[model samples]
Target: MFLSRCPLSHTRSGTAGSEAPATGETSLGDSLGTFRRQQDILTPAELAGMSVDIVGAGALGGAILLCLCKMGFGITNTLTVTDFDRCEAHNLPTQWFRPSDVLMDQAKVDALAEMVGWVCDRPITTACDRFRGDESRRLGPVVILAVDSLRERQLIWNNLRNREDVQLLVDARMGAEVLEIHCLDPRPSRRGTTRPAGPGTREFYEESLARPDEAFQEPCTHRGILYTTLGAAALVGSILRAHAREEDYPRHLVFDFRNFILLAHGEGHGETQF
Candidate 1:
């Protein structure tokens, strides 16, 4: 079930000022009212109280976070991001780090928070440490797992699969022009029920996991492409939008950008090519 929208008061970052508006100029509130067109799909008010935790600050994670920010998500509740890696020169092409961030030797989560703050007023919480599935603190209801390696995915899933607090888990995997997304509901299935709550059944997701060595390793230079990363982020945004709208969405989706083909299953099922 989706959360209900309520009255909320939010201050847009960089919009606060004592100066009055010049003649014929738009007010700060008017300028920040950019979501009217999308109000039918989702309004900023609906996202006010939602909390989200995003693991990893690499290509997919960085892009996804930016997308959420632009959509006015996590405005009332801060978005939490955890990552141990620092921004490097190589992350410029596919990730969201700027050259200045690399020169400053900023941690990925910190850099992402700073960058996001510039465009969005929403607050972000950063953890400059790795997530090992054994944190003392509780995670938000929504978790987006974008860490590298199948082992990390397996470990994190094992920790969250049975947790009642975690309602939605979105996992994104990418390799060059190929991208896969899994939107799983971690709540346990009802008693004596044969079907799982979401499309990402434990059995199906577990089958996708394997040893690190068993997975194909993309060459360093071809590991991430800017367009592919953005595409994956867009898909992730669509899933969030569906949830906000209380509509059905694909539980699992795979996209091959090179061939312009998409394969999706669960609530929405289809195979199409352009």
Candidate 2:
């Protein structure tokens, strides 16, 4: 649903939309009118200087990219996407891709880069390699982890935890009907969590790893839904946007889509593992 709203880039000849409306193109001045009003929370200047690197280009990452592009984030900030995965037939339902995309056999990051280039007309750097834990591997100042496996996520956190350049880290995860978004900004002396501030990531990873039922496919499998993916990505984008503006929201956020309950980290907020 949210993907429908992203104004994407298009090649003049092979573009998706052939017709340019009689109203003509909307100028950045007209499209960016909302930013001027939200100057208190997030101004264009603040978002301009930050560089964002998203680890995975799946459902969550795709939505986040589209949202950021629509908001004109890449106008000044550098947005780098890294994903080695390709779009398959199964991804058509949950991810933002057309039938033609599956046949192209293109990398997820490349496809997104093309789309975003058309939308914002901004250059998007893409990497077709996995994000292995490397201390010297620097994509940008901010990192967003949307990878599938637990080990991969932990590896990234451990590598960039103490790095001086890393300003923010956001991990977006989802279960059958719940989505959790965790943010971490490390300072040498000041700390928030007991350890590196995983926000239930360690517990969730261990439980999923030990679950015997996960070995065999059951009738009811834990898969991400299109609606849930959009919801989750919106929350991730919102949290990152708040982080850029230095606004106060939540260090950890868990939302229950089934019950329509939203909880933020605090005294009563439970750190539930997926």
Q: Best by lDDT, which number?
A: 1
Q: Which clashing pairs does model 1 show?
A: none
Return the lDDT, model 2, position 220.
38
- Report the alpha-carbon TM-score of model 2 versus the true structure: 0.73
- Per residue, candidate 1 scores C-alpha lDDT tens digits across 1-274 of 6321211112223222222222233334435777788888777666654668899989899899999878767554557788878889988988887899789776777667667767764556667776765566777778899899888988887778767777778989998788988877766652223245335666566667756677658888778788998899899998988876778888889899999988888765543333
Q: Candidate 2 lDDT, tens digit per residue, 113-220?
A: 666656555456666777764635554677788887566766666566556666666778766677767666543333544343244333332343354334323233
Off by over 4 Å in 1: 1-31, 189-198, 270-274
All models: lDDT?
0.73, 0.63
Query: Clashing residue pairs, candidate 2?
Result: 8-119, 9-118, 9-119
lDDT of 2 at 124: 60
User: How high is the lDDT of residue 144 in model 2?
Assistant: 81
